[model samples]
Target: MNYRIILALGAFVPAAAIAQDQPAETRDKTSAVISVGVDYEEGSYGTDQDIRSWSVPATVKVQHDRLTFAASVPWRWIEAEGKGTIVTPDGPLGLPLFPSETQVDQRIVREGLGDVTLAAAYALPVKVVNLSVSGTVKLPTADEGLGTGETDYAVGADISKTIGAGITPFAGLTYTMPGSSEGYERKDGVAVNAGVAAQIGKRATGFVAYQDSASTSDGLPDGQRVATGVNVGLGGGVSLGAYGSAGLSAGAPDLATGLRLGFLIP
Candidate 1:
């Protein structure tokens, strides 16, 4: 109970980083946004058994001057032959590892809130590339069935350059340090992303990204994924987005898809 309160409070902390790639001149514009989305993913995680999960998330973001603050949390439902919930922004990464065993396998059907993620991004002014630095904290607010119930921290930097033909190329690197857990001997990990975005139509944009993440613990394979998304703007502060992704390696999900709806206050 006490830890739950701490997790809720920690979510509002401005310690996490988010990427803000807007023009430097428009960084000072004050704005607020609310978004909601649902995602579903299925994978074997190098095991014979399959794990399927659904995540419904709500997010709020506010920008003041050049800094943006955001918080997001998800309600997750998982079905698998597993004992661990272990939810993260990247989704669950196989079952937990016990001190005695590298990984545990058991029947699991769980549903609840996973964790709360807090972030803040500070945009750096540059004429050529838009650069931003930020960090992230995942607060464990859910029970063992939904989360690891341990706090996690990460920091990252993003750089992007927009060139001719409304195309932008971007790259980012993030380092994550998982919190201590009883059975799970979590480890520090790094993830890298490279992507290119282009305008597809007057109101639509498309992007393709490749992501790779090091293993975070024993028995979990490294993650390699390819993802794509399309976003379209509707007049009057409304936007819609859709995404699809596939895993290229063992630890990543086999397939995932999601849709997002956003409203902006200017």
Candidate 2:
């Protein structure tokens, strides 16, 4: 083996060992939390080109007496080119007097409400287990011709079960209701998502998750999409998280990515 490889491995060993030396009970906690986060992401708004944006998301959560309630609001400011037609490919093509370059220049600045979520969870008096029902409403905040704002809603349930070694596995189900759009009739669909998070070191936790939503619109094909993300706790109820995912099927477009720095308040 190369000497450089040995040196790199030597440097990484201590960090890994320190991460694994955390106590189990130190990571186990049940507390009500309210968090605010900011993210910077560069991706396609509704097309193939890259669009960069800064987002603000604030979440409030409470878990007590075997019940949980939470809400999240996200606001975004986007900057890019060639993202005009939104989820549809017709707006640019439909204009007889409009040129492609003209549409690209005017479509750069786009802003609106991203996704709002509300959730309710109940612990069944069982050890290390809980069940939750959540609903997300996508308001018509983003412009239709320049963004994806047809207004949709989703209802889902989440199950979290704890096993050995401080690992919890979670699964979720969602039903989607389509929005109003010409030539794009509403079609209902389902989504399934699963994830796991584990304690790392004395003050950190890490996680990965995947989710697939059914095709609810004829405008796009029906298929599966997978997304994975990671989070690291920075102690004092503060954490840094980052996630990026690409489409597993044709229905997915413009590999989505995001990073968040969050502060939790008790």
For each candidate, give its TM-score against the true structure: 0.85, 0.65
In Å, residue 196's CA in model 1 sits off its true spot by: 0.5
- In order, the Cα lDDT scores of the candidates are 0.66, 0.46
Model 1 regions more than 4 Å off: 1-17, 82-106
Give me the displacement of residue 98 in model 2, in angstroms: 14
Give the distance in Å from residue 210's predicted Cα in candidate 2 to where it truly belongs: 2.4
RMSD of each: 7.1, 10.7
For candidate 1, what's the RMSD?
A: 7.1
Put down candidate 2 lDDT per residue, 157-259, tens digits, no spaces.
5566667876767666667664655544557777666667665665545555555555555545544445555566678877666656555665443355555
After superposing candidate 2 on the true structure, give the runs of residues whose Cα lies further than 4 Å from its correct spot: 1-32, 39-54, 79-84, 88-108, 113-116, 126-129, 139-151, 181-184
- Candidate 2 clashes between residue pairs 3 or more apart in a chain or in different chains: none
TM-score of 2: 0.65
